[model samples]
Target: MVDRRVHEGEAVIERAVVDGRPVDADARLALDARYGHFTALQVRARRVRGLDLHVERLQSANRELFGAELPRPEVLGAIRAVLGDDLRDASVRVYVVAGDRPRVLATAAPPTEAPTGPWSVTPVVYQRYLAHVKQAYGFQQAHIGRQVARAGFDEALLTTEDGLISEGSITNLGAFDGERLLWPDAPMLHGITMRLMERMDVPQERRPLRAADLPRLGQVFLCNSWGLMPVGRVDDVPLRQDGKLMTRLHEHYDAVSWDPLD
Candidate 1:
């Protein structure tokens, strides 16, 4: 069963809401086991980066999965109401089940910090169905991630059947060639942060990145709605750390303006 309270440090925080109503442990678990589509975003001071992109993501997923169009305004209103007067940093998850209307779940927590150290990733050959949709069913990814953790790796990076790197279990992967950023030309979820970076005029190229290309890449990074992070290693091979590239990427990313929810 999903716990009603999320224990973070000394604070007990409410972590689930269904259709604008707070969900107890049982309800949360019931929803957790069901198939649904979702989008996760970080909210700080009542604002979010790429809020429109997140909304569009939900709308598109809802239409594709349920044959129904999601009302964006209502979802935003529900999120605002759940947040109420306290607009501190939090994690927001908007979910859409098949039978029921979309639900907005949130938890009070500090924003995710960018990775300071490098990460070690193990390649796993697996592909997600409906790769563009951010569905709630992530059992495979979670299971693979756990196995990788047990194997002394930080995360699992999914690859195509032919050994082309697709993305991380929960994040989008990008490679740096010392002069430009290259994204894998594979079927994967287009991350909001990655879209923002592209809009900010970051030089990027989308092409198939295979396992053989890892050694030649100067740097590797992972990105999602939360932030951009540096990847230190892929499998047992170490990747170069380019501080200058990370600095430039962060500058463009941080420049993206946050939209106020209220």
Candidate 2:
């Protein structure tokens, strides 16, 4: 693996290992100029949920961006290098660096923990350049999130010019209408957790959602790799905070099968 071990016990926090070589991240990435596409997922026992989907995501993005093939075998070797031998659990991300010959970069850290949320968010008229690809578009999201924070909000709810709801800066938006789970059908990154939830035993739908519908919804929550969380506030409007529902959602997610890397 890449010699990222640091601290007293020499704990390894593997990240930015490019094509079997340890690279200076600053030089290789060139501040997003060389960055291509990526997929972030929590790996348990060297495996992950929706592993196939994650691979498909990378391959699709590669084809779209570079018209090249990102073989899973090549990616697997890079990821295995990052994980080493016996890692129980970690948060991992595989990135493709665009160039004459695309390179693979694998990043790993202690599994990402859930953020304490009942988040306060504000709606902003913004859309990602390539919303579908999990790429280096964090700069725009961070910018909007900071502006929302200045207004006493924890997150930014992205919307269209005409007030059609899309998604959060970093999470998928879901609404519980006292019966069914409603997901916004607007242009946004279709997250793995959201896709998994759709396959699970939950009353859900994908439909066009407007910003005005938040008030009409019984409860609103955010879903992502971290977990499900209640949306306590949408701008000045306070939505229902159902801890029980959140717990039930987590239970459902926990029941989903974990895919082994081997």
Candidate 3:
């Protein structure tokens, strides 16, 4: 289940500011040629949920990709500079583009709400390159996103060739076996929202969940920055949904304290 959300209106991205300054056309082209990593956050009322996690994500990704950590203050400053006090309730993304040096591009767009699913997904045999770090748009992820959209599915479920499940195209996958929650043990981004839910004291464990075992779960769900949603079906396999569990998860996630920006 790709975490890309449906905007309340057109998703218009504001001008991007790199390292606290708006870039020109040539600079924009320069950034396009470089390798980068990014993290998208939802800013609600000048605050963000999992703000520390978001920053740490950038810090760690910067270290892995650029050979040095982008300081936390600089990351915060870039966000503030780009947002320019105009974005209160909006979607803001901090991008770390690597050239001879690294640059942080902070940009904003319309805020998004989690898809209220009952979303259907089709499982495909695939794995992401450098899957741990949230690298910029990978070709395979985008390809599958388009394929599922054209194939009449809500999202694409990713599994290994041997049928061991890993994750969704963008969202983190979870399942309940009528008791404890199970997150796939395979390689995937340990998303911020997924980690927040883990702190809620839910009975959960990280383990290998197989795609062929879907029918045994009492509930199947997907989560990402937008929010959590129930899975209606995996391919042709109709899975059960627990409304009460979903309500509990959503409430806990929403109850997460927000970190103020500016």
Best by TM-score: 3
In model 1, which regions exceed 4 Å deviation?
1-13, 100-110
What tens digits encode model 1's per-residue C-alpha lDDT throughout 78-170?
Answer: 577557676567777677774455455443444555555777787899999989988785777767766777787766778988898888887
- Residue-level lDDT of model 2, residues 69-119, one tens digit each, is 989888777777777776668877788886668878777777765566677
Superposition error at 79 for model 3 (Å)? 1.3
Q: Which ten residues in a row have the lowest lDDT in candidate 1?
A: 1-10
Alpha-carbon lDDT, every model: 0.74, 0.75, 0.80
> Which ranges of candidate 3 are over 4 A from the true structure?
1-11, 24-30
**What's the ranking of the predictions by TM-score, best on top?**
3, 1, 2
Q: Could you estimate the TM-score for every candidate?
A: 0.90, 0.87, 0.92
Report the C-alpha lDDT of model 3 over 1-262, residue by residue, as the tens digit: 4343332112566667888998765676568556898887888898999999999999999888888978999989987887786767878878888776787887777778876659888888998877888877466786787788677787778888888788888888988665577899999988999888888766788888887677788888888778888888877888888888777778888899999987
